[model samples]
Target: MPQQYGTGMSHTYSTTSSSQPPMGTGTGKKHDGYPTYRPIGTGGTVGTIPNSMTESSKPVYKPTVTYAQTSRATVEPKSSSSPGQMYSKTRSGPSSKPTHTGDCKTPGGLPGLSKTQQILLSDTRADAINNVLTKNEHFKFSFGNKRTGGPGKGGEVVPANRKTFPALTGTGLGMAVVFLGPCGFNTPHVHPRAAELGIVTEGTIVSSMIPENGVNVHNADGTAPREILNTLHQYDATIFFQGAVHSQFNPGCGNATFVAALSAEDFGTGQVAQELFGARNNAAVADVFGDAIDGADVDKLRGAISNNVALGVEQCLKRCNINKRK
Candidate 1:
C-alpha cells in the first residue's frame, strides 16, 4: 500500500489492482512523491520560502556626519610707544639746558663769540665800516654819482668829462669810469664784456650810434662813402646799450658833460665792428666793378680795412640806395 497527497486529496491502497499496475507506472498522476506543481495562471495555490531562509532578511543603513559652519577671528597688530617716550629712551634723560662749549662745533665758528655775542659783533663791524666810507670825501670821488640832462634832436650827443680811474690791474673783474668833457665826442668803438651806462650832468647833447654798414660812403669806382642807414641817437638822461658798434658826437655848442659807467676797468675796441665794416665795403666794390678789387686800388683808397668791413658797407649802402660821392 502507498499513500498520496495533492490538492486536498489523500488516498491509501492496501492491495495492488490490475487497472493501476504500479505507482511509478500510474498514468495521469498529479504527485510523484514530491510537492505538487501549480502554474502561475491557474491560481490554484502559491508558495514562497520563509524570511529566515533568504540572505537579506535584516537590512542595514550606515550613519552620516554633517559639519557646522564657523568663521575665524581676526587679529590686531600691537601699537608702538609714544614719541615722547621713544625720544626720552633714546636720549637717556631730560635736561633743561644744552651743554655749551667754548669752541663752536661748525666750521668757521665765531672764534671769540658766543651765539648772541657773534650777532652783536657782526652788526657793529658793518655799521662802523659803512660810516667810515660814506663820510670820506675820497671814497665818494672814487665811486660815481648821478647826473641829469635832456636829449637833442637829429642824434646830437653831449660829452661827459669824467675823471679817469686807475686802469684795471691784474686779470680779475675790473671796473672804471670815464668823463666826457663838455662838447667832447667819443669816437665809434666796441667793447668786450663792458656794458656802458651814461648819465648827463649838464647842458643838452645828442648821442648817435651807427652800425658798421651804416658808415660806408665809398663806391666801387673809388668815390667817397655815403650814409647807408639812419643813425641811432639818444638825448640826455638816456642810457645806451653796449656791445654794438657805435659812435657818439656832441652837437651842443655849449659845454655839456656826461658820466659813462662801464663794466670793465679798461675799455678796449671790439672785433665785431671791424669785421662788420670791412665786409660791407668789400662786397659793394666787388659788385659794381664785376670783380674783386685789385691790391693797387684797395691800398690807394680802401686802406687796410678788413674784408668784412668792405662787404658790410657795400650791402648796407646798396640796399639804402645811397649814391657814392666823388
Candidate 2:
C-alpha cells in the first residue's frame, strides 16, 4: 500500500502534520501525504509568479479615435424690393403706353376731339353774319331824298338822327356822345332827370356848376341866393348832378375832346331855355333871382343866344328841396 496518511499504512510518520501546521509557522507545502514546513526565501513561489503572468503583460495598441476635418460656410440675407423700379416696369416704356378707355376715342395717336367736329364749330360764325344782313333790308326810311332836315335845321330844336343810332325807347336812361371837336365851348343847359359825367379826353377844359341866382352868396351877411362850384383842367372826371345847370369850356388852344354820358334818354329836347326865362314871365324869373334881377337884364341875356350865353350864368345849381329863406 501507498503510504496512507490518516488510514493505517506502512510508512514512517511524524507526530506533527504539515497540513495542520502550528499557528506561528513561516511557510508550508504538500508532499506525499504530508506537508513540509519551511522558512520563506528570496527565490520563493511569490517571486516566481511574475514569470507565469508574461502573456497579459505584452504592449497592447488601440487605434486613436479621429473625426474628419469639415468646413462650414457663412451665408448673407437679401435686401427688399424698391417701389420706383416696380412702377417704371409697369407704366413707363414705349411698349407700355396707357390705353384710352370709355367714351373718349383715340385717333391718329392724339387725345380729345376729332377733326370733323372742329370744322362744324367754325361754320357757326358765317351763319351769324347772314342773319344781320337779312334784318337790315326790312328797315324803312320816311324822310327820303334829303340828308339833314327835320327839327335840327331850324334853331328852335335839335332832332336826333336815327340812322346814326336808334332813339332811346326803353327807360329814361339817356344816350352818350364821344365829342372829338377842337377846344371850344359847350352851350349851358340842364337835363331834367339825368346826371352827367364829363371825362376830359384831350386838352384842358374849364367846367362849372352854378345855382339859380347869379350870386352864390346873398351878401357879406352869408344869406346867399345860390352856390357856384367850378373846377379847371381836372385830368380825371367831373360829375354834374341831375337838374344842375352846368357848362364846359375848353381853355386850351389845342383840340379837346370829351365823352359825355347822361342819364336821360332825350337831352332836354322839349325844355327850351328861351321859353322858360323870357320877360313875358318876368315874375317867374324874379321868383328864382329874388330882388337881384331887373326886367331889362333878363331880356338882354336872352338875346345873347348867338354867343351861346343866352343863359348868362356859366353853370346851373343842383336842385334841392331846402328853402334858404327859412
Candidate 3:
C-alpha cells in the first residue's frame, strides 16, 4: 500500500522490498488500505478512500411526519417524503438576501447574512446554525457527561450531527473528535443508520468489533467471541460497518484522540451493555442468564452500568492508575 498509494510514507510497502525501506527514503503519510473482516486496520491518510459519496448521495432519510403546524403553515399533507421536501415545497424560491459567503466578500460584514438562510431554512435550522457559530454546546443525548470520562476527567467528544448541527441536514456527513483519557473506553455500540470511518490521531487505541451473528461456516457455533480488531496508533484508520457493535479503548496511561466520520446526518448510537442493563426490565435481564442471577445482584449490575465511562478492562485501569469515578 505504501509503495502503491503512499510514496510519502516513512517506510514504503512493497512485495519484493522489505516492509521497512532504506532510512533515506522519502517520508510523509501512510495509505495502507486494509481489509475490514480481519485486522480492521486501514493504515490510511488524507485522500485515502476513493470517490466517497456525500450525504445527498445516500438514501435520503425520511422521518415520520408529524406536524403541529401543518395546517398553520399550509404544509402538504402528513405524507410528504423527505424532510427537505416537507419544508421546501411549502415555501417559495431563494431569497434575494445576501448570505454568509466566505467572510461576506467585503468589509463591514456588508453582503453577509445576519443569520442563516431565511427563505430556504426552517426556523429550527436557523437557530441550530446560530448556536454553532456562537456557543459551545453538546451533541444530542450525551450520557449526562459521565460516560465521557466524567466531569474534569479529561476525555471529551465533540460531535457534529443533524440534531447538533442542523446546517448538515442533507449533507450526509457527521463527525466527532473523540478524546479518551487513560484507560478510557468508548463502549461497544452500534450506529444503526451509518457506517463509520475512524482515524486515530493521537496515542494508541485498542479497537474491537462484534459483527452481527449469522451462519459463518468457519465459526458456525457462534459461541466464541470475535477477535480484537487491532491496536491502532497514530494515523491508523478503521471502519465500523453500520449496525456493528464496536468499541475503541485507550490502552496507554495517557490519552488518545480519534476522528470518526459517519455517512449519515443523524447517525443514532445504541450503547450495547448500558442500554441492555439500564432499561426498566430486570426480570428480562435475569432471563437472559436463565434466572441464574439473584435479583439483588441484578440491581448492582444496573448501578455499575449507569457509569458507562467507568467501564474498562480492570487490568488496563490498574496499569494506567486511573481511578473509577463513582
Q: How accurate locally, in lDDT, is each candidate?
A: 0.35, 0.36, 0.50
Q: Ten-residue segment with the worst summed lDDT in candidate 2?
A: 83-92
**Higher-lDDT candidate of 1 and 3:** 3
Q: In lDDT terms, which candidate is top?
A: 3
Q: Which stretches of candidate 1 lie over 4 Å from their true place?
A: 1-138, 142-183, 211-235, 264-326
Q: Estimate each model's TM-score.
A: 0.27, 0.33, 0.45
Per-residue alpha-carbon lDDT of candidate 2 for residues 50-114, written as tens digits (9 for 90 to 100): 33545555212121111212222211112212211110011122444446454332222243543
RMSD of 3: 31.9
Candidate 3 ranges with C-alpha deviation above 4 Å: 1-154, 215-225, 279-312, 323-326
lDDT value, candidate 1, whole model: 0.35
Q: Return the clash pairs for model 3, or none.
A: 8-28, 55-172
Q: Return the lDDT, model 2, position 21.
A: 22
TM-score for candidate 1 = 0.27
Encode model 3's per-residue lDDT on 10-91: one tens digit a residue: 2121211112222222333222343211111122222222346464442222222222212232322332222233222222
Better of 1 and 3 by TM-score: 3
TM-score of 3: 0.45
Give the range of the ten consecutive residues with the poorest summed lDDT in model 3: 35-44
